[model samples]
Target: MKRKLIYLFFLTGSFIFLSAQVGINTTNPQGVFNIDGAKDNPTTGVPSAAQQANDVAVTVGGNMGIGTTVPTNKLHVNGTDPLRLQGVGTGNSTTDPLLVIDANGVVKNIGTLGALSIPSPAVFRLETAQNNFLQAQGAGGAQVVPMSMIKNSIPGLTYNAGTSTITFPAGTYQITFVYEAQHNATGCTISSYFVDFPLNATTSRIHSTGAHSEGALSNHGGTITYATTLPANRNWTISLGRGQSGNCSGAGMNLSATSTQILVFRIGD
Candidate 1:
């Protein structure tokens, strides 16, 4: 009887081990190596139900998904939480830098947006009021009489009232300076010159009117014109003078508001 019983017991144990579902924490495992336990890797003596399911897969490459089973890209992220990239280390000294990759595979932070460019349009003008003039008197030789008022000026041009000068951007420019001047010098021959109009650092002749006679005063007026290429980012001023030739020793020159004016034109680059 003992021999027969032992054989039956061995047979029963063999059938259970081969046919029954292999499980560790529980009597039955839903799939191979469930999260809770597995046949090959089991809970040992611990007790817990294995994971409910398994897709039978492995991470073939670097890309892996979180909160997702089927990852579409490397380190794919999912779920309801927002993702963000953070900066590390000092951007130049504790200043956090924006992330960027260089051509040589170097990451760094840069100050400033790079270089800047300013636009320059051709064809402009700077004109003063017709009443603009200098009260120049006591003529000895050529004298500089600065234009006093600016009615209008082009963009990128600034006029200084204290210096009577206009500063403009730096570039090669075809500029022309015009001046309308008048003098009221009694008893002597009167002449008008454009000081700084030609920008010669010397007086350029505009127009001259001879005296009528002694005690006979008449208005004398004329215009000066000079054109050429000028330097950029420089200050320029146009002035009107009287008795530039030193002929009107005893007479004085006055500019008229009705006829006196200063006009500057930029016709080329």
Candidate 2:
């Protein structure tokens, strides 16, 4: 009977131990928490050492390296190599860069440029003027001297009497004319040559003159000189007429037939 009682006691202790173990299993999820190698319940919710190391190795998004870094937008690069884009070929060498557009885009490597257009035209015109002399006197025959006469006397120039033009096609020119008075034994006064711009009738006048003794000879002359800028094309013209002086007489001394007048024209830039 005693042995039977002892056996019952042992069985009761076994049941008690089993019930306590079941309660601990149900209540304690981690089985046992540790701090400095001492057994205790975890006061703060913190991953164990093993769990923390695993988290660092396989981060929530991925590895924290260049290629494995998390992307903020659709177009992104791996953390392993920042320059490399996702799904692009893998290599250290740079590939043809893809143009990335941001909220405010950027333009690069554009060259300098200049504008172009057509030019405008300029305006131009021609200018003309005249210079001459005229001499006349009361109660006597008159004479008119044209600028052309002097210009023709120039050596390389060809004078056109009818057209009152002078042409210097080849050589240079230095021409001059002057008028001097002379007294005649028959009481006649010589007329001095003069120049006049026929275009202006009223104001046409003669240049300064000098008088000389008669019975011998009295002559007057003027000068006109110029160099041909263009030897190939050169022409000029002038006109001549008799002068009126108080003692002048056309009967005794007549103006020479070769003594014609002329006009000069020059063109240059």
Candidate 3:
């Protein structure tokens, strides 16, 4: 009886050492370490590709694989929705963390969404009103210029002809306004003009216009560009103010051909 017991122990030890592979729920091991998650692996020879769908394997080089017998990377996963991460909070703000893939195909979250560049298509333009005139007002007074046409505009921008106002959406924008004017009266001279919006009272600047020699024939223009961020929707307008003589005539100031051009484009949040 002692000889029989010793022989059986030697045979079991030799089988474990010679095979050099461990398998759970599978007699025919397909890898260095295999787990038949569904107990569907074949009992005879190597399992087929279909049977490997229910198997997890680890290669001799320490590469692990799910739903596949061969693992080419450190952690290879196959099948639909093979990987999922829980407990990650919602990322809805610009300061929220973001997942990015590196050049080596490794996943990382080293930066926030604000650090990335995104495409934005928010732009607006109000232009092209011929025969529009700016009535000359004396110093310290202003006359709102007329913009009758909407040459180009997008959503988030609205124009009201009744109020002579333009409503803009909440965002940071680079705004540019250009105008072409000429003196219509001999005695009147326009020293300055401005593109004004109530929200931009402090930042808006007066553009200088040199004296015009010809009463109605002389041509002059000014352009102003400024950037601002609006926390909410706001209205904007253009006006002629600052350094104007009372002698300026009614039809003395005229904007012809694409005058009173205002272009606004959103740059950021």
Candidate 4:
């Protein structure tokens, strides 16, 4: 049986039922079932803006839309408020303002940051959206730190573990290396200790010297520092060794997790 209930007028709280396309309060139905809402005063102080034309309207059906007939998301807002998200120095300085959503689904502008804190080393690492000036990482042992540890790192530098070399592209750079070193006198006669930055070869050296004496209980410790220009395609290795006058000259020296470590960082271009 073919049936239709069509009303060419607008009304509220009206209902019509049939196994056909029912147009309640209007001659046109947009969906399988459509309701032509009544002409009423809009929040914009305009009349019939809901149906007669596009104005401030709260529409709801399959998808809820604000000022739009075609809703692309669950809640689609078609027009701009031009006032929301307006402020200065938000979510930053101690006195800056912030925009936050409340439990009542109202957006409130507050004069403080959120209460949440980033508790992990890997989270919220950057100080700002554009620049990273300092980087820090802590390790328990004397493990070799590779470039992968930097959450933000610029290019043109390389580290080779096999040769203990750091290669930099032809440019002037200020390199800082800090280390703690100590050697037991068990291997050979103690003379002097040294930490060396050998560029290209051991003969070309930058040295930090320390003192030592003979005894199993005697261990000498100090730091090594160096800075220079690296020609294009040049590499350098940092090393720790006993002084040439010591009996341990041909003997090898090793660094333990507790006894020794090297901290290296680039200060500038």
**lDDT of every model, 2 decimals:** 0.41, 0.31, 0.61, 0.40
TM per candidate comes to: 0.39, 0.26, 0.52, 0.36
Tell me the tens digit of each residue's lDDT in model 2 across 33-118: 11122223233344354322212122233323212112233333332223534786643111122344355332233221101111
* Most TM-score-accurate candidate: 3
lDDT of 4: 0.40
Per-prediction CA RMSD (Å): 18.7, 34.4, 9.5, 16.6
On lDDT, the candidate that comes out on top is: 3
Model 2: residues >4 Å from true position, as ranges?
1-163, 166-185, 198-203, 220-237, 252-269
Q: List model 1 lDDT by residue over 183-233, tens digit each.
A: 445545544343444332333354544444334434455555555444555
Model 1 regions lying over 4 Å from their true place: 1-153, 171-186, 190-192, 198-216, 243-246
TM-score of 4: 0.36
Alpha carbon deviation, residue 263, candidate 4 (Å): 3.4
Minimum summed lDDT over a 10-residue window in model 1 is located at 112-121
State the local distance difference test value for candidate 3. 0.61
**Candidate scoring better on lDDT of 3 and 4:** 3
TM for candidate 1 is 0.39
